[model samples]
Target chain A: MPAVSMPIAMSELIVRLQQESPIPMDAELRCTGGQLLALVGPSGSGKTTLLRALAGLVQPRHGYISCSGETWFDSAAGHYLPARKRRVGYVPQHFALFPHLDVLHNVMSGMLHRAPETRVAAAHDLLERVNLAGLESRKPGQLSGGQQQRVAVARALAREPQVLLLDEPFSAVDHATRERLYGELAMLKQSLSMPLVMVTHDLREAMLLADEMCVLHRGRTLQTDKPLELVARPVSADVARLVGIRNIYHGEIAGHAPEHECTQLRFGSIVLKTPYRPELVPGSRVQWVIPSDGVVFHRRDRPSHTERENQLQGIVDTVHKLGEITRLAVRMEDEDRSLLWLDVPSHLARRNEIAEGVTATVSLTVAAIHIIDSTS
Target chain B: MDWQALRLSLLLAVATTVLLLPVGVFAGRWMAESNFRGKILLEAAIATPLVLPPTVIGYYLLVGMGAHSPVGVWFTELFGRSLVFSFSGLLIASVLVNLPFAIQPAQRAFESIPQDVRDAAQCCGMTFWRSLWAIDLPLAWPGVLTGLTLSFAHTLGEFGVVLMVGGAIPGETKTVSIAIYDQVQSLNFEGAGSMSLLLLLISLGLLVFANVLGRYAGRLHAYRNV
Candidate 1:
């Protein structure tokens, strides 16, 4: 038997889930011990199915799920453990707390094999840990949504499971309450040494909570990387859009600067510089993304650099004010009328007097530009 | 008053209700949750008693339980007793006639429970039987209780099926409905009137109790979702 603290690894988790209309799915994921892997996708993207497969709830058509050297499922071996036999703490979307059991009993119900006294003590201790100490006697029906979710988490943990699976656990709660729950979960994550997989459609929540993120689309994993890495270097245009990178354009390699190790890309009549890729030959067509935050707007009175390497002079096509940030659509002075999106702080937008029809000089930071092969 | 008839009827009703509790729950759950070929056919068969006239059911029971039939002959050889025109025969008739009443509402109750609750129970290391006891039964109790009460009440008022299968043996199979019919035929107006009033009150009371329980079940279901 492997120690409880070791990571749970699942390889080639191939499942064909039948829905009202069939959606293809082939998902693979990995989580190190004590790390949180957030599985994010749009609805019907097989995020929940993957979580269920890991918990031994959904039997995949082909796969092997192993944790600490224990085989939970293997197609070749014809070995599959049922959900009850798999030591997984699952917090479903609705929390699924037993309506008949009081909070303490709900937690204790998972510890059925423990001694009575020990179960009681541990249940109480867990309730306190979830900030639900005095509500132990309350039924799930009487508690608030957040409180009920807390009870669910505590109950799942009471099982002393080897892995924890949460499916949109915070989606039901109000935003204010969700923030607090996020704080509680972050603290809880520090103490738990088992692998945890959370399924969420909320990109912000996944970015905020997950140590690593696996972006799923149409039942397949597009990319798996640290949140920052995923946002910074999405593998494809679809992945770039999913990660909130809104500024993408078609460009071909114009030339290479060997001294600076950078490639110049021509987008219509405009040219830009990005880090060089060895795979790229001159004239190779590719898609490039510039993070919206990387497009900087210079003050109207500031002295403009005469160098035209990374700078573009364009007329602001539209302006949208969204609380703290202002989003602008800038149409480049090119034949294709290519538009670039830039997000500027509202304060900066006000100082620069940026608006629709205003000519603005925006610079795309070369270090922030990323390119992907068009074929991928 | 035909006290023997009343006693036998009550006994038959109680026994049928008790016997059908586990069967109803198990069948209800299976019907609600499982999907396989021929499920619709099985459901239609279970519901046949609800749509068919009581005499149709009584006629089948009578034929099936007669000593000439294979099942009846086997029972006679094994137990050394006839199944037809006996208290046991009436019990079987009542169970068949009231099965739909018990199963329909129970199936609805089981179906109403969210699937997530069942999944959560299994993920908590609960076996099928344990989840039924700890979660399904308690969450669906009011509806199940309503089913049981409806079955009991329907059995108490049983007439055609009991009359055909049990044939009005005074101390054995004669039930309240048959006794009242006998009294009315003999022009004993007062006796018939009293028995009629008693039956009316019991049926009315059970119906009211079931209604109250159904309302409570609705409230509980709403609470669970909250």
Candidate 2:
């Protein structure tokens, strides 16, 4: 009785695609039920292509896509379902609301097969859910950008699709409106139990709304991980940069301790420690990144009592005041003459009298030093 | 005043416009959305009527519909009459001369619709025909209307092709333009002047109405995008 009473379990989605035109797409992605996955990349990086392929708007020459136990596309089997039969709710970058249809009709347009009364009732209920309760008769052209987008979302949800795809859904609105929409989306995500995939070019947007982040570059999946993990331990320097990491240095493996599972890396004259991998042998070159938040800076006049494992003295090459934060570019006084970027609160910079010519003591915490494999 | 010639001309124009609507929409949407080999050649072929002299097209139609030709023989056997010098002959010639006017503007309208709009309609479970009816037709309505009006006006003024095929037969094949030409030949300047003025006023009104509608449609499209 308990087994029969359980809700229907949502099936996992798997997509592998390869194509060459309209911006080549070579990506493999997976998402489970109740999870929001963000596909992020630069412009022309095939993010939209991948989303379209999943929605069956664009077909790949070689691919296999299955969602909720349905084989939407399988090139090896020569099976392909058209977009009309895919049951996907896609909110394109421009929202793409029907201009001639009123808000209620736009929502009801997706429910054409249902009874007339049911479609009207469902559309009104959806409009209410999206906080557009009384504007049902207003056409999309008469509404503002945010209101139209809300109508678009309501229209998409009216069909009750198994998968929801949003392509840069909030990029069209102003920043203030985007923040409110983000909160609204977060609240909406709680009730929706389907797999949602959002394509975005903004790293902050991805970190704010997505449960997992997938970074793409040149039509290839660079890395996929939790937002924090992607920021801390990117698989490569390119991935680190794409995720907004500012501090990266070229280093070489100086020593490897098999007993302790740690590796010593040499960057110029500074020796850093990191969790070792079997592939990183001594004398091999590597690229490494240290998140700006992980770098501890102390005034040279009053040094802190923290451990000095990877301490270095450097001159502040430049100081950039960005709102409440100050970014300092430090030039190391070591043999490599490497430059390190650090972000400090503006109040702290003012209190410490940190200026472009000031000398500062910075420490690179061993646990935060991430060595990325260059082969990828 | 040759009211029968005026009525025949109006019938020919209306019939040609009504017949060209479906063909124009189909061809316009296809050319706007598709990329194929020899696309340029296909486009040029469709637009040849706009650039080539009307008499040249009339000559070809005359030869092609002559009794010796296959189409002429089939029509004669089927309808128990000759294919030349008839209202049907004038209608076909008018449609051929005005084909580009019906297609080019409609194609521009279809092309103006963003791909996202089509994709959004598809994602909503609308089939190709359903979307065309619900989204494409409505969004591109102004341009389609302009094309139809232009075709109607173009067919109303047709002289060379209709004269060649229909041969100016009074009450059966003669149209308003032929009537006006006949008046001019007989030194009846007053009749020719009145007919020409009527046509000028009608064509101007249709064009102005289409321009206003097209501008309104463009604004509507801009609002949707914004």
Candidate 3:
């Protein structure tokens, strides 16, 4: 009924929410100022809901959201701040610009609490930052998709919020516009000191823009780590798949080959040497993944010593040329549905004769074959 | 024409339009945005005046606000006068009868406002009232114009409900339509014809104005999607 205690003074944003019905989720997330955390999940995976919860739009059934020494929500204390009170900068999907207002007034709308005399100059300054200075008089309907997106960004930043939340902000734009916005956002990120959380389904976009990625699947946070780390060594198979890791396989922990400084894993009787995972005792079954970049296509013309390291011979089941790059799905002779996807330059693919039904061997480096401790 | 009745009709129509604007907006927005099992029942209740005969609604209003009824007694106690056959009583009856005309178009317009825009307004340090003024009202201005115009025109031409509830009081409740009926009964065909033609022309003018506002709003809506 009342708040008697003081809000905990902290620098980072701490959000742990539990909600039932309408996307039923349980998640705990943390992001410090100047850090960008990407929420990566498939549709219906509750990524948007989580972002809305952080914005104070969706009230969580339990837990608290604290940011920069202020408590935004705490279900335990029945202290839930309204969306407007949170002072969160949220750029919703499609940019959602006020259709009636011109670009300058739209940005000014976010500065309602500021003095009227100071608003015009500040709004103009924001428009300049967004590269929309000359387009101040233009309505949202008149501007291009990219310009509209910038207006949304300027409006969000006008409030000087403690946190910035972007819900698929670039989704409405064309490829060319999205690419431009990506660069703009990267530059904008340099000026922002608040915790910025972006929800994106694109793993590549997440990796490009975010300092950290939190992978969500079916309302649960499966993992949170640096983009490359999440891709290279996911904590679980679900996380491995969510991060777009293509070569996940089942294996058993064979004895550690300490003399060679590698751990041996039995992939259906084939002993694969991986970076030392000594904590996994012999005979423990595990799941592991390697990125497509790690899957090197061995060449018959020039055989190397490392080519023999964890080299598995397979017949190329599929060969797809993706622009200058070619993807070959190599099916191991002894396994089923176990396609090791290998990327090769188009000219190299031609020289190596990597095509469907052709026999090929690829090597997995000891460091690349990362064994996940949990599969759940 | 009975100019006193014509002036009274204009006064009543203006009051009704002003009174019902907020009511229409509230009901229209709620009906447009909310989804519930009871919503259909609420919608049907608001639509009663559209299907029922004017006298039937007028009869209910008369009874509901008669001297013995709770509302009638309460009004008499507060205002020191009988509720029936008064301007205030007539205004209530007109508002009730025009609910559908004022609310339906506004509801349709509010329904078309993109949900994302409303959510964005909430996150942009805006209170609900601020968003209503800056976002909802501007976006739905066309429908609101349509609602206000229709209700004002309808109130000017109201006859049976006004006759039943207000009983032809000069300079009080004797509206234009009732005046036209009176002229016809008194064998003043010329006066009746003049007033009828005038009502037709005013109604047409309002309708045309509404159409113009609608086109402007439509252009604005289209520009937003671009």
Candidate 4:
């Protein structure tokens, strides 16, 4: 064992989210043990608001936030610890690096009042960890935007906070830098043992970094699950849309049978099979979820065995090229105005001879088709 | 040369700066951070002595501080004498007359600091005064120094106020400007010329000092903004 012992393991965070506003709802979130929880939502979705409430920056009109039995904020008892005492590492959207201080001083700033002696060493270690070695003498203005952001991260970590809250940390950087920083952040979280909660509108970033994903809308949590589960089984049409599920069908359960039967999903003359359960009564409203990647594009017709599963015919409305993937917006001739979006690799798109305003058949395996009852 | 006037002027300028520097710092800080009603009005009122003719200020001071007035009587009771026609009276007038110059620069320096920087400092567990002294003051030093120099320069040029209130008593109430006026009145061009040349040099030196100090502060602020 090393001579220096680790700080005591901190408590999990508990946030009872409520507000006295035009719209009202009760939300209770418990993150037990040390675990990364990603709050994913669109803009104006109240993720930042929740982060602020947890940090005691903004007092929620009601509810409380407790971490490991330590009270940070409790409206009932009037116990609201200031932001400094809460010991949270909050990296705001703008990074908020002190313009006056150089990289070294910015990191050491959080340490000035407490443990002033170890401030320099701690700052240096964190900077080195973030791969900003020997850049301490440079002021924030002198560094590149990405380098400045890394310095801000180092400063936040210098305090050795128990929990870290990051608000769109990489949204300001370019794609290449954003990816590099994300890789560094992944390594940091593994070594630091601090649970991180990051808010990002970027679906791919959230999918890559989050351990548990939360889908929020209008200040409410619609679904909270694993990243894979969030994509596989979205709770609502909104959640499905948020996670980039391009093929969402508004269908009615047409058939139900005994053990392992099938529920016939009818959208526009096009019907698909979902695992049959007794609860899936005929004429009941249901939503089917299929990710854009799950839908395959092809030129030549395949065998009926594969075609019987989850295939639909549509006209290619538009082809939008985005980096490595080409997004094809295909219009289904079905009566249900459901649009199927197929994401094909740029190479595959070039090889398949797909073009805008052309006829194409996109297919999704039945196993890839996920059905959810509207009553949920 | 009328040395008495030169000595009084020097004494008045230095004493006024020393007396009002603390108040100016506080007021400047308040103006930078605090939000209050009629702030513009208060600023204008403080600057009235700078904008209004010195003779008008001198007339008001004369009437307000004379031995017969209530305030003058109370002041006399406290200090065993009145302020009128005294060197100490000139000191009070200089502090009042040059207050805006002292406060304006300091306020500007303080105001130039970004609010986010202060918020970040507060989040790092610093109290208001702790951050102000450690962070804000160092950043605002150039402005404070500029304010000091301006106040000193303005007070050194005091004439109408001292003549109206201090009554030009040799070795007691007379300042450099009053002495120069006395020399001119008595047709002593050589004495007046010597005094005028000295004042000119002093004014130039202070102005140059202020310009350099202000430039340094501006650069620091610009770097921070970047």
Which segments of model 2 are wrong by more than 4 Å? A1-9, A256-262, A275-280, A374-376
In candidate 1, how many Å is residue B11 off? 0.5
TM-score of each: 0.93, 0.94, 0.94, 0.82
lDDT of 2 by residue, A27-131 (tens): 878888778999998998888888988999988888788778777888877899998898788899989998888898899977866777799989989999999
CA lDDT of each prediction against the hidden true structure? 0.85, 0.86, 0.87, 0.79
Report the number of the highest-DockQ candidate.
2
Angstrom error at residue A106, model 4:
3.7
Worst 10 residues of 4 chain B by lDDT: B116-125
What docking tier does model 1 reach?
Answer: medium
Which ranges in model 1 have alpha carbons more than 4 Å from their true place?
A1-23, A303-309, A347-353, A374-376
Off by over 4 Å in 3: A1-10, A305-308, A335-337, B33-37
Ranking by DockQ: 2, 1, 3, 4
Q: On residues A1-376, what C-alpha lDDT tens digit does candidate 4 reach at each position? A: 1111212236577777677584443555656555778888888888887776666566777777777667777777777787777767777776777776788988887775557687888888888888899999998879876897888778777766767778888987888989898888887778766667888898888889888888878888888899998898888889998887878887877776444466677776766776555676788777788887677777554524473367677788888889899989898877754578878888777777778877788777666677876776
Candidate 3, B111-224: lDDT as tens digits? 888887888888887897898899998999799879989999999999889999999989888899998998999999999999999999999999898889788777877876
The residue-level lDDT of candidate 2 at A234 comes to: 97
Distance (Å) between predicted and true CA of B143, model 1? 1.5
How many clashes does each candidate structure show, in the order listed?
0, 0, 0, 3
Q: On a 0 to 1 DockQ scale, where is model 2?
A: 0.81
Which 10 residues in a row give candidate 3 chain B its minimum summed lDDT?
A: B217-226
Considering just the first chain, candidate 3 attains a TM-score of: 0.94
* Candidate 1 lDDT by residue in tens digits, A48-99: 8778878877787765677656678776667889988888899999999998
Better of 2 and 3 by DockQ: 2
Best lDDT goes to which candidate?
Answer: 3
Quote the B-chain TM-score, candidate 4: 0.96
